[model samples]
Target: MIHNKYFSEEQIKTRKQQMSSQWDTVLKTNEAVLIHSGEPIQKPGGLDSTYPFLPHPAYFWLTLRRRETEILLYSKDLGWIEFHKEISNEEIFWEGEKNDILISSQGKNINSLENFLENHRFSRIFHLGQAKDASPEAFELKTLLDKTRRKKDASEVSFIRHIAEIANSGYQKITSVLQPGMTERELQIAYESEIFRNGAHTVPYETIVGSGSNSAILHALPSQKIIKENEFVLVDAGADIFDYCVDVTRTFYSSGEMSSQHKDLYSIVLKAYHECVAMSKAGVFWRDVHIHSAKVITEGLLQLGILKGNLSDLIEKEIVSLFYSHGVGHLVGLRVRDTGQEENLNPKTYFGARLRVDLELEENHLITVEPGCYFMPAILESAYQQKKFYDDINWTELKKWYDIGGVRIEDNILIKNDGNENLTNCIAKTEY
Candidate 1:
């Protein structure tokens, strides 16, 4: 069913052609393909209840269908063949009537699995991922698909742009109604309802609404604690539209006015955010961008009397990890953290260890540039005990902002040939 009408028939056709061309380039001799659409799982201890059905990312990338127990077959001779299970009257009674959007787009190549397998034979069957009851050979097709899918096509870009718009709308709605005394869960409801009202059926991930000290915890879940005046509210959320997602994060001041210290920290994070986006372009190494962000954070901390050593020495010593722990950004597309074709560096340092994607930037690549600073008590105490920055640290000044929580500014960007496009730029960085 085309509940969301953002994508058209032409767009779907173009996407299929792109996937076919990309797959043909990577297929080897005597390799036939079988890509499975996964099924829904039952909830533990719930009678006849199941979790929401989500199609495999690769399967959705290929067919744009969310139905379970479907199989896609591909061979050099036969091309694309979709084997979908026929809907029964019992299914229709329970789940309503099925739509023919997928079938009409797939054409006459659709058939039953039994008939498809009986008519065609393959010396070697290679499955994209694990498929039930199939002993198919595993090849490098998964890696190839990941690499090919990194660069979004026009249709994919358009879809993501729509998703960005929805997410931006949600942020706007949440900010307008934000007030002191509201619980974090209430804020989450405000954000999610706005997204759904704007036409997104699902959020890409959990809606993060961290208030006060809770904001210091990365990936903090919504809690019952009431938001107090002058506290920092960090919201990181995304809208999922047709499997494509756009991640965005914005930190807000509950009282609509930032304290001097908070303003300084916010300015530093915003500066690092803009600098990272400016540096994002084809041929530039993502790791270099991350290092530059770290340097900016380190300089900001030094200016605030939090560190006393040379900037370069502090960055080299990974002292910035004491505040900015996660990576500067990551690949954002069909998956929030889209798989990078290359392997991560996995540096031993705290900051470097959090790097999600270490590949070079390329045209058509979609990524998120999020730079954050937090004053987590445990991490600070651990670093202090370990003597990681004992010589360079200024403990007194740091303690003043220890309970300030965190501040993060994130935006989605699409790398282009000439420059890049900021998809989430339409959303404001601050309430003012």
Candidate 2:
């Protein structure tokens, strides 16, 4: 385990340096740009979460450092500017204020929140209000920053790998205690407990614990349903550390039977998943990876008698979408679906092409390579009865394993110069 370090001023300053470098990429090119500490979240009333309350991630990313109720703006003309609430004497008496204490883990010297940006002069400074009035503030600083944050730097990559490490530890705890009689929620709690017990401030997203047929649902949430014997369980979960995240999914047997059907499906999914992961090299078109995965899915479905048509015709028509509708995967980082341009592949050709921005992989980009095949009885019945692509399917055998649910192989990856790095390797998503 890495030694835990609390937020300190030095760390804040170091992170600030990194943020400055990241901001330079976009801001340096524009004639005049405003880098803003994001607006505060609204509380129950009209009040905003301020000085003592936690600032949102966008706020943190731009400022590179902050305390409750503080805002910072940056531009070439106005080096670095700050804004804060005016601490009235009456307010101080009502709530004891510690003026000298370090506000951030980084030892940013203390200052009155109200006095940070009092006399700054920009052609126009950003304000936290409706978009109509601010002519000069045309673009949202947060949106622009989101686009910039898609790819991780070395430090951000380390943070994501650290999150994956913690998730692996949680996976270990669940493995030791997994059994048939346990409810899905029971398993979920156990998994989340381990995540929080470690350094994770929050989970990357909701934890999914789909057992048996529930696995067929692509994005199943954990419920109180009990797992059964001779059933396959699928779990997709992740953790967030310092705002960076890692997502992973695994399927296992409650009875540990390792059925032939289960093994066969696992093998196919793993094949498609790994093939896509291996294709994540610099300069490779993102659509090519999805095409490769689709081809593998087509061949696997043919072997299983799920699809029956001219292979080329079927692939061209996207007949395999019935079983594999989602994309190969998405970019991963600070946000589970981190920010980047949604311009990787053409939107019309790829089902979820919007998720594939920057399709040609770049060095240090992180992505998720998840490929899945599901036998959804509802989709099958509706499409088959209507003859909607029915000519492309072998209905008989597919119905035989209809209750067997689905299989998805997912992993978080780092796109490298020559190849890729699998960050979620330790999270154990499958028997493989």
Candidate 3:
């Protein structure tokens, strides 16, 4: 089906040209822009071994390539230029052929930047990547980049759909092999193998495989803990073919039918996922969607006796944060947990601090509608101490449900003016 990677050189060049127009609007007579493909870090205590390298999101947005230490430069005069680190015969021998997603960017040697930097010395540079003192402040330019990134281009939408299909294969693998006594790590291997085997260029992030009580620990690495009977196994995983991304999470019952209690918790999260996804049309505020998910979850919790309070008060007090922590989801594309230029949204807003992307939902935006309900010990404990909202929670009732751990069902959503699309809905939540 030709889905491993889809960005062609021509498409990348077209994207670059679009960026050039944006750059032209910002860069003055002598100003330039330098976006960096970041350097790889050597593994600690290992002299030569290094972790896998994924370029800076900004740099990858322009080049769609994954070479380290490369630079994409833009100026009104020079237009678009890529500077590849001059390679050595030793590097060529060890690394073999420098094959990458081909781009027609005929760039200069990194050393040539010495002459260019000295000659044109930009009046005010707009930098979008790292490395020290590379350019001037990039406040306005970054805003342009972030605003542009919020909406997926046509090719970006196509690639995300393809990756979601690949990721579903992995989810199916885990669901099929689920049995008692298997360690979480073993399940992770089964899931990862299928994705890579099915042609995912890489996993967008660490594949999470948490079963039983461990599932409450969001983003935990798969462990050796044995999977007991029919407990919940929560997996948050996705695929990356050329860094085209999808972040999907599905919680599964280890064996046959789940218990009624387990079913209730799962259903709550499932309902929240549905409600949030349905709310993802253009012009809706993303934060309002998050609150809507919280309301749905709080309603479920109230029914289950885990929480007891007025719906509005429960949501406003962040009482739902006790059970459903973390933002419903964030923008997922060129990078997982995208480094959104959305400013410091991460202020301890209690929906688990890292929740950033909160722009008004717009057409063509790709986001994740991942509302979760967990019986996390840490969150429950802290909320108990918040005396003001103390009476609202049913702390004692939560004890009975702690063993179910957590339940999260996520899907990538493509926002539209009329409606929204659930890109990963094929990775089913029930009756599989």
User: Which residue runs of candidate 3 sit more than 4 Å off their true CA positions?
Assistant: 1-5, 131-137, 344-354, 382-389
lDDT of 2 by residue, 1-432 (tens): 221333344554565555456555545422234333344466566563443333445555544443455555456544444554455688689766634322433222225432433544334444432344354333444444554555566656667777888998888878877899999999999889998898787787789888888998988998989988877788888897645689888877788768888888878888998788888987787778887888898888887777786777777777777778887877778667776453333564553333345367778778888888887889778845438776777767777888888888789888888998998897765545
State every prediction's TM-score relative to the real structure.
0.91, 0.80, 0.92
Candidate 3 TM-score to native:
0.92
Q: CA shift at 216, candidate 1, in angstroms?
A: 1.1
Clashes of each: 0, 16, 0
lDDT tens digits, residue span 1-432, model 1? 442445566765576577667667766654577888777789999888999777787777777776777777777767777776666799899986656334344533335566657666566677764544333234456666676678887767777887888898889988898899999999999889999999887888898889889988889999999999998999999998656788999999999568998898888898898889999998998888888888999999999998888988887887888788888888888878776543343642345445557778889889899999999878887855448677888888788888899998899889987779998887888732
lDDT of 2 at 336: 78
| Rank list by TM-score | 3, 1, 2
The TM-score that candidate 1 achieves is 0.91
List of clashing residue pairs for candidate 3: none
Q: In angstroms, give how far residue 363 of model 1 lies from its true place.
A: 1.1
Which model is ahead, 1 or 3, in terms of TM-score? 3
